[model samples]
Target: MERTLLIKNMVCDRCKTTVLELLKTEGFKVQSVALGEVVVKDASKKDDIRLKTALQAIGFELIQEEADVLVEKMKLALIKQMDKGDADFILSKIAEDLGKHYSFLSKTFSQLEGITLEKYLINLKIEKVKEYIQLKQLNFSEIAYSLNYKSSSHLAKQFKSITGMSMTAYKKLQESDRKGLDKIV
Candidate 1:
């Protein structure tokens, strides 16, 4: 039998690769792995328990609730938007792609995650800004424009607000204070 499992904290391609390898190592006939989900063939009850234990050991989670799954999907959708540098597309993209209303998504994410969706998104973007700053390839203006901020100042304000320091200060202390994408929430 083929089984699909919804996972939490799968925020990037590396996460997919990690999960795929782990599933294979556990002797499941892995079918596919994507952010927040995986499919495996010939799984049994014992397999479920073993897989859960393995996943937890690596900072991943086996999500069971339908609402929790939806929240994870919303998080992945937002992460995709951030990767594409299309910051303003959150509302429409999530609504159309997930087939849910913005209000519903926002409410559900807040209720499940203990933070508003908007704050969660801001955290994601701030982390990206930190990454770009660490790379030192893009100036503040370019970074702000690429992430779709109104202006570098606007981006700076948000960055400082979220990170508790100005971009310049962050640049000075650039010793990898960045959080893993999965730890954003």
Candidate 2:
């Protein structure tokens, strides 16, 4: 039989690659490894413990509880939306996609993560904005639109609020400060 492993902190292509390599090196028949989960054949509780130990050594985690699984799912959904340039907090849409009631998801997310989904999303967006700024490809107006913000001014207000500096000031700064998606939460 196969077992599914829900993981936390697998947020990027590089992360997926790392997990895939680890599974192969550790002699697990990994059926698949995705952003936030892995399916492996012939897994057991002992395998879980060993995998957990190996992943933890590399700053990742094996999620064991249902609530934690849901939280990781929620994070994956938000990051996907952001990457697709469809960032929006449509509770109904998020709920429908996740197959849960909006209220329940919100409450459970808050209880498990100690922060509302909206707040978490805003933080993610701000981080993305920093990344875009450093890349220097898109203008502020373009980024604002890509992120689904109302306007460049709106994005600037949020950027300043989150980072304590103007967008132009940020651009001029010597340091290209940014954080990885997995490191966000």
Residue-level lDDT of model 2, residues 1-185, one tens digit each, is 89999889998889999999988988999999888989999988888899999999987999998878888998998888777778765656778988889888889999988889888888899999988999999999999988889999999999999889999999999997788887765
Q: Which has the greatest TM-score?
A: 2
Clashes of each: 0, 0
Score every model by TM-score: 0.93, 0.95
- lDDT per residue for candidate 1 within 2-88, as digits (tens), equals 889988999889899998888888888988888898988888767777888999999899888889988998888888878877777
Q: How many clashes in candidate 2?
A: 0
Error of 2 at 40 (Å): 0.4
Which segments of candidate 1 are over 4 A away from where they belong?
none
Superposition-based RMSD of candidate 2 using all C-alpha atoms, in angstroms: 1.3
For model 2, where is the 10-residue window of minimal lDDT?
83-92
Candidate 1 lowest-lDDT run of ten: 86-95
